[model samples]
Target: MLIDHFPVLGLRVRTPRLELRYPAPDELAALADLAVEGIHDPDTMPFGNPWTELPPDQLARRVVQRHWKTLSELRPDSWALNLAVFLDGVPVGVQEVEADDFAIQRQVHSESWLGLRHQGQGIGTEMRAAMLHLAFAGLGADEAVSVGYVHNHASLAVSRKLGYAENGIGRGVSRGKLALEQRFRLSREAWQEHRSVEATIEGLEPCLSLLGAGEE
Candidate 1:
């Protein structure tokens, strides 16, 4: 029998209009559909990772595999908290907050994507703020970081709104092409100073220990 993992199964974080959580069995299907439908225009590259270049179907499969692999492996060194971004009960996208050796890093990195239809709604900003709350307030992280292509103004704008300051720039290859990326960081102090969103977390207690926290 599969021992139900409460930490993974019961995680949840919420903002005014959205709830970010680990997808339950029923919700996971919906999340997969959202990925299959495509998060952005096929012609546009929004991520530093070239995995987004796959054909629509392949991209969808990868999304499903990611959810499964993360759960099955349950590794301590690398783990990703994949939250299905819901707006008014509909699956609109995926928000991934991740870390490597989080106990040591004391930092988390974020990545997210909304369907093309959902772009320009300010949902991105609110969603990102929700994750920030989880990292800083919920998990006691020292800082949070995110990156975007230099030309992706919308993403960079969202990061700026969430109090992320430009850290530096780096060149990397994506799909065999050199790309310039702007890295941004938000220290706990900056997050406290600039936090604006009102958030509440539910169903997180069971997972608190997994967050590398010493005590509740």
Candidate 2:
């Protein structure tokens, strides 16, 4: 049987050539290896945090730790769902859907990283669209938000493709360094109006309450 905590095991979102899902153990191991191989190079920081500056093994450990922590501390109010992105049956990177005070916030946020080798194939946009489908259609979210470092044009472009409008810019300290972040938001109505990908879900029934919603 699929794991109970993450019924999203069987739940998948597919594009013409990519598949997204919560990784099972074997798949998660493969994903860890992908991270080990390198998602970002040491000198370049696609993410605002300097976390990528860590050695490859450390970076790989961090990826495993995130999955472990999320499952161990599963909660309704705040949670992180990490889906391994696979292209042609091989792990390429991770996509995350997260929320804080989700039971009350009625909102969610998206984040993701594609292995440097897989960066420009339009996979980012489709993966994000799939997450929005789950947030707005599956979880009944009112809005979904995302933030990109001011200089991360590629991420900003993905948000724009999904019809996310600029909310504002804010300053924050990341990895002990100051950074500027550009916030973006998309309402349920806006998502429906602008979405273009075809996404479907399965195995969400048992986990629906975890999302703070009743079956629709």
**TM-score between model 1 and native:** 0.91
TM-score of 2: 0.90
Model 2: per-residue Cα lDDT over 1-216, one tens digit each:
536645655667676677788776887887777777666655446676665666878877788888788766656777778878888988888888998877777899977888777878898888888888888888889999999877778888989988999999988665567778899999988999899998877776767677665544
Clashing pairs in 2: none
lDDT of 1 by residue, 62-162 (tens): 87788787666654567778788889988788888888877778899998988777778889998899999988888788999998988778899999988
Segments of candidate 2 deviating more than 4 angstroms: 41-43, 174-176
Candidate 1 global CA lDDT score: 0.80
Q: Each prediction's Cα lDDT score?
A: 0.80, 0.79
lDDT of 2 at 15: 69
The candidate maximizing lDDT is 1
TM-score of each: 0.91, 0.90
